[model samples]
Target: MKIELIYPRWKKLEGQTTFHLPPHGPVVMAAALPPGVELDFLDENVDPRDALAACEGCDLVCISMMLTSQVKRGWALADQLRARGLRVLFGGIASMLHAEETLAHADALFLGEVEGRLGAVLEDLAHGRLQKVYNFMQAHPPIELVGPARRSILRDELYHHKGVRMVDLFHASRGCRFKCYPCAVAYLGGRSFRPRPMARVAEELAAIPNGRLFVVDNSLAQDKEWEKELFRTMIPFKKTWCSHTIEDDDEVLALAAQAGAWYVYQAVFDTSDFIRQRVKRYHDHGIAVEGTVLLGLDDQTEDSIRRLIDFLLEIDLDLAEFTVLTPFPHTKCRDDLRKQKRILSDDWDRYTAGEVVFQPKHMSPARLQELYHLAWETFYRDEPQSMKMMKLLQRAVARERALGTYRGRRRDLVRQSFGRELTDEERGV
Candidate 1:
């Protein structure tokens, strides 16, 4: 049987530098499919065409969504495909979060991880017995069942930034132990942290052809011993990577740096000394820091938001991404906002963290929106976002060179060169 897996695209945060990192959910799901199925994958962010063209004589089409903003587009695509007499299924994070609504637009809706589960779904499809919903939200498969992502289905050439090949997304673990106020990870992946076997992780890392990767684990700070062992297993690969926060310990940091840690997406929520020291420790370990700062939190006033931006600069973050607090479905932030009647809109499209859809505790919605832009502008005033990103790329390249894993730049493709000013057309003029 043949299946088409399509990842629907969503609008990126306007305040950040625009680029597409390959999606991980679809590829990982692809690996879980039973053997001998011909798979056609399309990441609509880079491959703009809808799945109709790829679904020729296909048995099933899976619409995988990872963000709230993608739900509308995913529903539209599913509606369009089903109209043409093709069977369409909805899965992934966004689909789980919005399952009740997504089922209206899908032939089947799958929730929870796909490992060791797709065979049954496909068997039902083959026998014309497809169910309306396969709810596995709480029935997570054993972590050992997770396998290497099926990247063979990806069109690798389409994923790049300027002339540099973007990092391939990989995950050594699943689930997050911490449930932040604005995050739905606990609701989606459970509060227990489930890590893949180290052997499996090593095998996946070795099989990945890319020299750089973005380890897309929800957070690596959960199990200290596991984090250390994962880094130790990765040391020989010499592949530079960026990931979410690692365990904030001297030994863990040392292991990570030895494992070719390039940079990390460290959250900077406040101007406290503890946060300052956390950023410093990452930098001290020779890992570049990219501060992921969320603005317009309940405690944040205009002055506090501005202070946070200044603190980011003071800490010498290699790059900073500023986003407004978005209350996505199933997150505590959304529950609180809705209860207080502070949520201004139910429009999921505008829920892109760049836009303010709810009233702030200390300021008006308009004021919070203005501060969002101000945070981005103030952070990148001296150094353009692109320039800061290019430096991170350079550091990755240097690490590769030192480890004898560097491949000379590929000059055949045409895109804006890093460190060069973006053209008017490239800048959306």
Candidate 2:
């Protein structure tokens, strides 16, 4: 059987950074497929050829739709694939929550983890007895069996920035302990935390073949004992990594730093004293902290919004990412806004965190949107204060790249002086 595992383009608003990381969901699905299937994996964001041409002669077209920004594109691609008499299946977080809408485009919809469900789907395909919907959210496959993501199919060069391939997305766990109103993790992965076995996780990390990684777990600090053990086990691998954090204990923070922790996305919900202390603790442990601030919350006003940005600088956070409260489908925030009839737009394009699509309790939607843009503009403006913080890192990165190039050239020149033919590695090509 020939299958085209596709990742549709996610729309990004102007001024927003288009993150072109390895789409872990689709590649992981490709990894989970049963044997005897030929997979042509195309992340359309980077591999842009006509979608129809890309999937030509493929028996099944499977698209993983996780972001609202890309749901529309996934649907269009699904429609086209179905028009060509190809079987189209839609799955992932976005499709899981909006299954009814997704069914309109796909011949089948796969809800929940692909671990146990994919085999049955493939069997159905082989026998020509595929069902319209496959439900496997209830079946929790043990973490060890989740399988490694198939990365050989990736075009790695297309995902680099400033000579760094950024980070490889790897999941050591599923779900989160906290059910934040605006987040969809709980909805998709459930409230209870499920972690991959420590040995299994270490093996996956070793297989990645990259020093920089982004562990896509909800919060690595949640289970203290397991995290300590995981960190201790990771010492031999010596890979630098980062993950998101909740308020963590001193011991866990210490363990994380020892285990190659580089930075963490610590949410700054407010300018509270504890938030300041938390940032300091991370810095004290030699782990940089990135502030993930959610703007336009019910408590935020224009004054408060500006004050938050000022507070970020005052705390000397390594970096910051600002986002408006996006009401994704099936999340608590979306449900509440729907009850109040405050959702202003059904358009998925506006769902990017930069745009305001729902009514807020304290301010006009327009005001909230304005403040969102202002938060970014003010943080990244050409002022010495802002530039000093951000540009310092840019300059440091530039220096590292130049130094690496110099060392490579120096080595090549020495080899040439020996009158030896250049090996592929020595050519510095």
Candidate 3:
């Protein structure tokens, strides 16, 4: 029997970055399917046409989705596949928490981690005993049970969009240890870090093309020693990479820089002495750090927002992304917002981090929305600072493209270059 795994596109939001890469959830789910099962993976974000066309012959279709903005698109895809007379199964962070709503459109719903329950689900389907719901209670499954994702299905041509050559896509671990109130990782993976073996991770990285790699892990610093070791191994490859980091550890930061990490996506939730120290480490390492700020946290007052902006400017971060805090389903913040009657919008489509979902403690919902727009306008709107960022990014793009050509890498010369500073004028920052 043939099985198709589909990932839906997110709703378009102004000023927000649209990810044209494959979704990791469906890739991991494809990895876990029973051996010999005729499985195909489709990420509509990158391969929409092939995905829609592949829906024809599949015996069963599974959709992995998020709760925020992808709800409508996900359901629409499910509805389409069902119209083709294929049994539809839905799962992911969003579907896990909102099973009843998802079940309205899908024939079966799997909750929690897909790796643990995938085999049984496939067997049940083969024997004509499919159930409406399957839940995996364990938070972390054994590594042996987690099979390698079938990423080979992704073609080299898919990476060559507009000009960006795609490189390796990897997940070093599962679960986040932080209890950040608004983050879904804390709720879904629990407050514990479960990492894959460093040796296996290194092997995987070595197997991928020797270019810029993107680590989709929650945060590289979650396991300091493991991250350090990984960086040490990566240094030899001299391949630029990007990953999320909470704060800068002096040793790790240095190692990451030497290992060819061009950019670090750091989360600056609040400004403090600790944050200052971390930012200094990035500056000292000559690494371009992109500071991502959450503007609509409960504690963010008008003064605090202005202060945060000033801090970001003071640090001269290469790039920054300011988003309103969203309380996704299954997160503590969502529950709290529901109880406090702070959620101003029930429309799941607007739940993407770009939208203001709840009224802030210090500001009304409308004021919060205005503040969100103001933050972007103040930072990225044809200002000198924004212009500087754009020039930096343009230079970096040219440099990376040159390097790609010299190296004779078949990868498209997309903006995969690191250290290019983007200005507000160029990016409309």
RMSD to native for every prediction? 2.5, 6.5, 4.8
Task: Tell how far residue 278 is off in model 3, in angstroms.
Answer: 1.5
Candidate 2 lDDT over 1-429, as tens digits, reads 898888888766677545577878887787788878888877777675677898889888898877888888899888878888889989888888778889999888998888756878888887999888988775667667876787876766556533345568888888788888788888789888898888778778778876567878888866888888878877676666778883467887787877767778999988899999999999888778878989877788888888998898889887778888988987889988888898889898778887888888889988888888787777766454344444534433443364342111233234331223446564466
Tens digits of per-residue lDDT, candidate 1, 220-289, equal 9999999999999999998999999988999999999999888999999998999889989998999988
List the candidates' TM-scores in order. 0.96, 0.89, 0.86
Off by over 4 Å in 2: 382-429
Ten contiguous residues with the weakest lDDT in model 3 = 413-422
Superposition TM-score, candidate 3 onto the true structure: 0.86
- Sorted on TM-score, best first, the list reads 1, 2, 3
**Candidate numbers sorted by lDDT from highest down:** 1, 2, 3
Question: Could you tell me how far off, in angstroms, the CA of residue 268 lies in candidate 2 after the best superposition?
Answer: 0.5
Lowest summed lDDT window (length 10), candidate 1:
413-422
Colliding residue pairs in candidate 1: none
Residue runs of model 3 more than 4 Å from their true location after superposition: 16-19, 48-53, 144-147, 382-429
- For candidate 3, the per-residue lDDT at 107 reads 82
